[model samples]
Target: MQQESYSQDANISPNNYQLSTPTKEKKQNKTNQSTTIQSPNNNDFYSPKNVNPWKTPKSLLKSNQKQTTPDHSQQASPYGDRYIPLNVSRNLFNKQIQPFEIEEENAYEELLSENVLEIDENKHSSILNFNKQKPEKLQTNKQLENPKRKIDTLPIKVLDAPGLDDDFYQDILHWGKNNLIAIGLQRSVYLYSVDTSKVFQLTQRFNNQVNQIQYTSLQWNANGQILAMGSYDGQLKLWDYNKNAYTGTMNMSSKRISTISWANSNIFAYGSKDKTIHICDIRVPTYSVFQLHGHTQEVCGVTFDGNELQLASGGNDNRVFIWQLRGGNTYADSQYVSWEIKSHKAAIRALAWNPNSSGILATGGGNQDKTIKIHSSLTNTEINSVNCDSQVCKLRFSKIINELVSTHGYEKNQICLWQYPTMKKIHQLEGHSERVLYLSASPDESTILTGSGDETLKFWKIFPSQISNNMSSLLTMCEIR
Candidate 1:
């Protein structure tokens, strides 16, 4: 028997193998000539099951139908059960595989290039069509025209408030609607008439000097006929300026009264060191109508709303309380506190209600907090806050303008005027030698008066009077004659 050996080299030609019978060669030649190579459709080219092992797929052929080298690496068994080694048949497959030429257009690149060309054309066209011209000069006459009036921050009057206590918690000065300014100086209360420019002593006190019974707070009724004064002896005295006589006196629980606010013509509220607020009626001075008890420390500031139906009080406990005055037959059953706010980190002493808007209140904190908070009385929610950068000692809203004025201590030691709603600062008045402890507005809100520990009372002509064009003119014509 003869044994045949297969060559290990893949470059061996077909003739190197033993030749088959002449009849099989003729059949192979006929089959090779008659066979037509059909181009593969998308489905057949992507489907592995449609591939034929005996012949190269149409995807690997050229359009000219040229003869290609036999790829031994791609040649599989007749039954498609096995593949040839790639390393041994690399050269043969390299010659048969042609680099595919992609004639399909890239839609994305075409769209992007079109957009870029259009932008370039538009930009070039705009530049080409643009006309350059010299700018016209503004007329000198138009530039010189001014429409707004100028206001000066100078003080209209400065007077000596002798023996004025340099206390931060006590409110000793107030301006009445009848153009009367009352100030507590030691044991004496003096009334200065803005109309006459005359000062008169309203009361004399012998025990006030010996017992150190200094007046702490002063407030006038709505009609400006009755003046209420609170003394260090915990006594609230009402005096009639017309009659020049004391009308009544009510004793409070605390020895010192810090603040007093007139709720109405007949009712007034006073805050005391006893950490309570007493709402007393001048008609019935024997007993208070109602007593508010929420503050853990001394109540320093108290205010009434425009309608006199609501009251707000601030204390050294860093808390603010709002009370509703219910209309009923009995005083105790008529009023109750609505809400309590504990937002300040320091003592709260300055409080004011907006006269122009309902349910809006402003509160100021002491030296530590140095912030002013605006609140909504209806919902008991804080609307806004401003860091004044100094201790706020007093807050007053203007009746003639939509502005709020605040007196600050420590670093600033000045008065600031802020526009309402927007809270934008309009101006700052800096004339006080020390921290301003009291703030009051004139009857028409055209002037603001500030008292400081410097023991001097200064008046700021803040709002422009409608009757006069400037502050100097108004002061000369109205007060100075």
Candidate 2:
């Protein structure tokens, strides 16, 4: 037989060679073995001739993986790692978990303080578990428990104050340190006892005088023993209420004395319609110690600072002046006039000095101006101002808090409580049928009394009481006894 095309090596065995013609399957196996030999790796079935030149190595690898891996598209999870729809999540959460029970809308808004939902994906179905959490308390509700809460909007007490003057330019009401309130009603001055709730006349009505003497202003000494009354007939009268005796009466001005203030228990100051301020020592009833001339019209208001070193005066000329209390006879010296403010468009009838702050003064304008201005006597400039939208009749500062209470006239006839520096209106009280013209605070500063032209006096509890534990216990002990 013809020798087969075998290796011409001496190591070849004749039994391993196919001596006859190769079968069809054997021929195909030879072709496949020849294609595999073209590649560098004998285990790699992909050869250069079998793979397309345009296809990358990554494509060939993916084709091989697809042929080996089984398809699981028909058996996939219903949930996914991505976010579920809001509606579907809500339904699932409602069915799986119970939410917190909130009593208020604010509490509901603060509910679910944390995202406590935890998912377990090891099981066939997704399970969401919610943990319980405490909702935070509302700030507004906690603030209501404060000791210094908001004041009541209504008055605690009311009384008829008939014959009270309706003038917006006069200060006819004052509360003394002895718990006594003095109010000028036309030609008479009456004292009301806060403890006894009794009313007594301080001055009798005089019918024999040529011109009827109507009481214009009232003020009390620091000791609350002597009260100073100004009259329309230009007279200044002092009375010792404890003794029920008249101290003295003198003609301090030729015009009506519209206002009066005490620097101490002895040194006194009064303003008149003659456009002058008279500062005199009560010890000497003969003459005034100093005469201040600044305003061109009636001097309707006058106040002394807490230290008795400066005096503030306002008038119908729309001018406010701060005078230094030096040994001087007149403020015309120019050096004695510490500050002069003409920021008001109408007459200024209200003036007050901050009891806690020296050189800080507050002045209120009349009907046409309807504004309150705060001034610094030390800097000789206006510190702040607020438009009241109504006639500012009077102003009183709280001794315990940094608050200012103002009485209004002409339309609304309301009383407003304002926070100092910021000048924010804290509360507004309305009860008077006519213009609210007079304002005064109790000795403890826990209450304020407002006198209106409608002949009504309303008492409002404006500040919290500052009572010590010992005092409260003593009061309780006395009540029990």
Candidate 3:
């Protein structure tokens, strides 16, 4: 229950992730994949049962052992009951947040366990929804503040923070804030902490959310820890965190920082409402990377090439401009290296880089233009664009599968999957009731987590086996490329 605090950066943990035992995919013979043990039946008087099976399943056993393995543990002690003793599941998550909550002392009671979320795997046509049981409400912090603030499940699983007031909310997103001991949010970034089951110490925030709040760009570093937030108010802030403390601060721009990204290392870049893109060093903000002109309107999103040598900027003007770092780490040599085919008809809302492919990119927009397009960073051509029902709210690339996942803002609130180069709709991830403002996936590509304005943060499992159009076709067509 103790909350830990840190005053500096060296002490930051990776946040909430821990490595599991290494697993190798080397191919093995089917026989090598498994083995069955047989037990003699007691009625037959010749069979001796192997009471415990290690990693072997009952279904896979030979018919001989089936008769002898069960019906005899009735009078046995607890250990004799085929019990799988529990071990703390510490290595289970790559990154997680302590459930954000609003405390109300004895006024609040626990929500029932029967309430569980159900998921439907298809995007464009499946119907899956949250079980609608309301939980006992909290009496403080939130306006749902009165004891009636109702929650329908375990209090630990509360989705949205209490909407009662600004202070009632947990504006913080700690990597390991709640339970695990050593982790949580340092700034706005997620980090690894020891145990999330316990409360985590939170760093004092950078001035709470201000009115006139609007941002054109927000980015997570490749590690997914640090976040650069640029606002329309012409102010840029960098939030550095772990479960411990705020590390440092840098002043980015005065032209209402339009777009921002961690180009590489401590190197950073920002496109502004000022109609120019500014490249600067994180360690030294005064050192300018030089500003370049291209967009006639506000630059909405910016992404850096894998080499950090190029920057891609997109805006409401319906264009994408690729800028190159003239020499070394400095952008003082910045120039419009290339441009993509006129991609969006409306303001671009999101742009993301593919970590595995240096020459690939994706961009999203804000309207019926809900289309997301993929571009060859190398050829600077439109490989293809996806058609969506609404504005593309958020975009993510899986480093593991090398596929793309995007959330269509108000359009569907559904998650859609796209294969790498083909840009074809693979499967639709349908869930979440509101606009998803933030979405993240594990570096290993296991799960997808999204934060929605519906006032709840929902975590989703992206099954590797989801039916893909191409995968389903192979069985019927028997065509191999």
How well is each residue in 31-92 modelled by candidate 1, as lDDT tens digits?
Answer: 33332222222223223332343455575564465544545464333333255668769878
Q: Each candidate: what lDDT?
A: 0.79, 0.78, 0.54
Relative to the true structure, candidate 2 reaches a TM of 0.67
Tens-place lDDT digits, model 2, residues 1-481: 0122323465543223212233456444433332211222221233333322223445458675543332325322212335467999788868867688967555433443323433233544334535468668767855674445777888899989888878865778999999999988768888899899999987777777766678888999888989988887788888897899877887858988888899888888999999888888878857367777778899988888888898888888998988888765463557678778989999888888988687789999988999999988878888999999999888888877788999898777999988888889988998898999888888888999899999989999988788657766876889954
- Model 2 stretches astray by more than 4 angstroms: 1-148, 206-211, 285-287, 327-333, 467-481
Residues 8-40 of candidate 3 have per-residue lDDT tens digits of 244433221111221356443343332212222
lDDT for position 358 in model 2 = 75
Residue 325, candidate 1: Cα error in Å is: 1.0
Candidate 3: count the clashes.
Answer: 40
The segments of candidate 3 whose C-alpha lies over 4 angstroms from its true place after superposition are 1-158, 162-232, 239-248, 255-259, 285-287, 328-334, 463-481
Candidate 2: what lDDT?
Answer: 0.78
User: How big is the positional error of residue 35 in model 2, measured in Å on the Cα after superposition?
Assistant: 72
- Which pairs clash in the backbone of model 2? none
Q: Candidate 2 or 3, higher TM-score?
A: 2
Alpha-carbon lDDT of model 3: 0.54
